[model samples]
Target chain A: MNSVIFKKELKRNRKNTAIWTAIVVVFTALILSIFPSFSEMGEEMAKLMSSLPEEYAKALGMDEETWSSIIGYYGTYYGIYIILLIGIFTASTGATIIGKEERDGTAEFLLTRPISRGSIVWTKLMALGTLFIIIYGIQTLSAVIGLLIFGEDVNWPVFTTMHVHGFFLVGFFTASGVLMSSFLSSKLNYMGPVVGLIFGGYFLNAISMAVEKVSWLGYFSPYHYLNLTAKNGVLELNLITCLGASVVVAVFLWISNKRYLSRDIVG
Target chain B: MNAIELSSLSKFYGNQCGIESVSFAVKKGEIFGFIGPNGAGKSTTIRTLLGLLTATSGKAEILGMDTSNEGARIRERIGYLPSEVDYYSEMSSKELLLYHAAIYKVADAEKKIQELATYFQLELDRPIDDLSYGNKKKCAIIQSVLHDPEVLILDEPTGGLDPLMQNRFFELLERQNKKGVTIFFSSHVLSEIQRMCDRAAIIRDGKITAVEDISTLLSKQMKMVRLVTTSVNNIVLPVGALNHHQSGQKHTFDYVGPTQDLVIWLSSQSIIDVTLSEPDLERIFMNYYQS
Candidate 1:
């Protein structure tokens, strides 16, 4: 991929990154400020957790009470919300990267340049990766500040592992969004398939939590990978399965580039 | 060396028609005009040349290289202006041109962009979204030519420009041609083509019905003579001549035969004045379409 095009794309996305960063920082700060009271709230959550069936505990990673005790107040209240927020933000950015040029009629202009279609797609993906890193970095920094102020000596390795798992989830969903954006012509069409996949996956995971017999269904949701409470509190994954899924996404992107190079530029 | 060559080139969208069996060749340093109506596949052919869309069939070559196989290399030597000047709205005009110049690997890109901005009378710092339609078109033109490609393919390059700016654009094209650049442009405006192109092709309904030297096509196709006489006398005209009434005592006849015979025949009557007008491209286009 050409660095010049990649840099240009990065420059174009600067405004969007700045705006999203501020919102994320403010939200993180606000959530962290109130998270110290979670210890008192944890007793109630523990009672609520005890009443739930075994499947619900397994799905929410509540197998042991100590899993909630280690992270203290803020972790219990804000953990899932943070993961969902990062996933949605990353997916939306990826979706826009592929569709924005077409929406603005700039695709024809860009295609006319001496760059290859493959290079264009690669540069867009790289730019999106950079944006994801920046957003994630800002959120991680804000979390560290919150931990410093709240007098919590957190386990650095565990915290890092959880955030890393969140990053991978973002990457996976971003790839999905990029593939969908390639196939769909309009932004609305692109959003429909991606949003459906995300919400449907969440709904399936939730239903699995409510019923023990279908607990295996949680494996179908990428959220299963984000559950970082297993064994040593390290992010675990079926590497072979994840690699296979990534290959499928790569194939989709390749096919998308082929179609883009050959398709007519519709108004 | 020829800059572009298309032989029996055709493109179609499923059952819908695009350009069909269109053949033309543009020599180096020549300004070739592609004249057609809207939806006449001019843009389609241009896009195919740019490798933005694959041709359904037929062969096209740029600088003696197959357009499909060597699209990136071909694009390195050609600059194109799409009909709609869509650009990154967030970028300043200078940034957009520099970005394109870098992609084309233009040497001394910054200097080239500066020169083009000055020549086009565009403000380099203005964001593309803040510019007017004509100014946006000027920016698009500047971006296409900043790399100084050997061949320039422009679709409706002056569509939204004012008269003064249009003249300036033609002047810029003339200057580029003088510097040994080949230009192939498509436009619906015949007068601009008449003023700028050395040769032109008229496309109708996805087919190029005629391709000829512009002046020669006009001269051969537009052969109308108007005569004013003292009386309205019934004049017997030869077959294949178009006779039309201009006024009570004036008449116009369009023909392809020798004009000397018509002049002699008109001299026999009490003629007041006779005027021979050169053929117009618009008239030829109309006749070609009607047929």
Candidate 2:
């Protein structure tokens, strides 16, 4: 990877990365900070859970433990909003990191430099990975702090398992964003499509869980395979699914680099 | 070996032609011009040579290295100025030039950037997004040369510059050429080519129609002849005269033969007045373009 391009890409995306990380951190704190209130009235919370339809509660991955424990409550929203927020930031960034050069007509200048196209793509991907780690790592750290500050008897294993799943899920979404951008026009506004893709995957999993008649649809969404929601206040690491998603991510990045190398950079 | 060479190089967008079987050579330390109108495949051929567009077929080489595989290496020794200046708008001109210098690993880049910026009369601190087209072009010029490359590939390099900047640019190019740097200058403006190039290839409809020395092109014996003659119902025109016109004995035609033959023919005419003048490169270009 070319360090010049790598550093430049990172610097270019720093402001956006900071803004998104702030949003993710604030939301993490807000959600965890509110969990104590729910737990304070556990008896009433149990009744609230019972009045909700079983299918609806199941679809949201919420149970009695959701209010009784901090991990379960955060897990419920992690799949719905936390991961989606981080995924949208990372995925949209992945989509535009290399493509923005083309859309702005700066590819001509950059491509003419004494660097191979392969090196440029690889370097840009490295920068994207670094950005992904920054946002993801910060959000995870904030969650840890918030859990410590606001909860009692926190399930560390379940939280770790959920974050691991979060890592692969956001990674899969980010890779998908890169792959999608390579196939689309460089002039495209990638935010709409990137947001659509991440939100679409989450809703697909959500919808499949809400209705038994269409549960088979869960097989198609990455969210379905990489479960972000806990079961009975416990979440298990699906090593096989994570490994499989890792391979898919690798393949997506490989395809993106290949497409970038061979494509014409028109002015 | 030639500093730059193309062997039947072609680039086609599926069925549409960008440049077809385009071929030429520029010797080391020579200023070679690629002259063509806009969309005449001038930029396409340059893009293919620089590896910005994949060649559909054939080959290109710079300083004895094949462009297809050794593009990065070739680029290390070459500087390119695009027809349209498109740079990172977020960067100041200084930052962009430093970035370029870093990519090339040029030593003492900050000093060079300062010098070039001063030479071009550019304000280095302003963000590129705030710069006008002319200022951007100036920035582009500085970046192209800041690394002291062995070759310079310029496409319409004077587009946004005023006359003074254009002259300074030409002067800079001449100095670079003197330092054994080969230049591949591309322009649609005939006068610029005439002023700077030693030899030029004329391209039209995506193919090279002619490659000739600038001196030879200028000294082609083609002259625009206008003669106002006394009344004569019939007159025999010389063999090389073309596009003859007569308006009440005010005759005009382009003569392409020896001057002596034209003088002898004119001596026999019932002449009232006569004028013979050399055509500018623009007229000569039109001749080739139409042909």
Candidate 3:
């Protein structure tokens, strides 16, 4: 996968990795640390949640039966924050990795090198591709460590399902972000659109949950895939949803490579 | 066979023109100059050759390989220094050079990079963002030739360098040419082109107005003649010498036509010393632009 470019991308992205990893890991730990208090006051919390508007509770992913279990507790409380952080971390990084060369006027230096655009795009994708695995690794490790320090009786299968499903869910944005970058004629062209699309996908999930007429809007949001509270929070992922997300990721990545091959890189 | 060739290469950005049907060729082991003013398509032609921007319509070949399809292989033997240089801002000069070395798989790259660094007087350990414009230009020059490629494509390589550094760079280029490297030197600076190029192609408005040997290009258009005579009043003016100026015993002017007539006239005069040479490319460039 063009090891030279892969290593160069690694060096270019080291600081980004450090900043985002710290934000996600520390943020996840902080959320998990409150689990003991959540467990002690579970009944009062349920009453208070029920008294709140049903739409607000559902939009915020507050489910009483799901909250009774540790994994569901973690998923409902911490998953959204993790998703947003990763969505931003992946999308912004994906959008800018190739665009940076154009922005800094370094494309002339690089494009003249003895490498095809296919190799260039894929190597950059491969570099950002590792961040998905890394952030996932850090999340899994930090969540496990947090669970040990704050609670008991962890739901191992469900926790693994939530994170695994989360990866595919967030990967769609990452691929789309890269594809958007490939189509931009200028460095500043696609970044705002990418961030807007991410937030649009996020709020669509909330709006779809809040309004019955627009429930189908949830289909466009990665957060709604394999709904974490489904089937009594046992973490059973629908095979159809998994297959569909895979198709989307593959399509976006393929299109990104193809578009990058011919698109003029301008800044 | 030509080392580099372009036939009707055109690039249009939307309705605006970048270049239009530009064509030229450089012989093997030749130092070819490309001269034009800003926005006159010098960069567009070179960028097309390097495969950085695909041409709208044309055929381009380098080292017997098509630039459109075989860019990677063509670039393997080519070194390019762009008009304006920029790189990863956070990387030090040493780090950037090493990165290129690894990418190009350069042999004994450490020694080569160190040698160029010293030659350019570049502080290798300082971050690129901390370097001055001239220092960055030095880094660009060093990287372009560090691989010792068979061809060098330099665009305005001396923009930010002082006179001394520019002189050293010219010397470096001469050394490389002696080793049989084909060079395509592009500049808007006429004096540098006059000083360095063996052959030059004058491009304007996206077209090559003239491609001629430096000698023929200058001699056909104008020659600058300087002569020291005991009496300026005693000199007989040649048939087509223009803009005569005299200061004490010296007379200078732009001359055109046969050297035989000028020599006969010079032998008749009480001459002290005389020097005849091609004028700079500026007047020729102006003629091309105006016409």
- Each candidate's lDDT (Cα)? 0.75, 0.90, 0.82
Query: Compared with the true structure, what per-residue lDDT tens digits does model 3 show for residues A137-251?
Result: 8877998899878767877777777777777777888888887877775447565787788778778898899788999999878778756544475778667887888899889
Each candidate's DockQ: 0.68, 0.86, 0.58
lDDT of 3 by residue, B29-75 (tens): 99999988777888888888887787889899999999989999998
Which parts of model 2 are misplaced by more than 4 Å? B221-241, B245-286, B289-291
lDDT by residue (B154-234, candidate 1, tens digit) is 998998888888888888899899999999989987767889999998888889877889777545554567878788776
What are the chain A TM-scores for all the models, listed individually? 0.81, 0.98, 0.92
Query: RMSD to the native, candidate 1?
Result: 3.8
Worst 10 residues of 1 chain B by lDDT: B282-291
Q: How high is the TM-score of chain B in model 3?
A: 0.82
What C-alpha RMSD separates each model from the true structure?
3.8, 2.8, 3.8
lDDT, candidate 3, residue A142?
A: 92
Quote the lDDT for B181 in model 2: 91
Ranking by lDDT: 2, 3, 1
TM-score of each: 0.86, 0.93, 0.90
**Top TM-score prediction, candidate number:** 2
| Candidate 2 TM-score to native | 0.93
Model 3 pairs whose backbones collide: none
CAPRI docking class of candidate 2? high
- Quality of candidate 3's docking, in CAPRI categories? medium
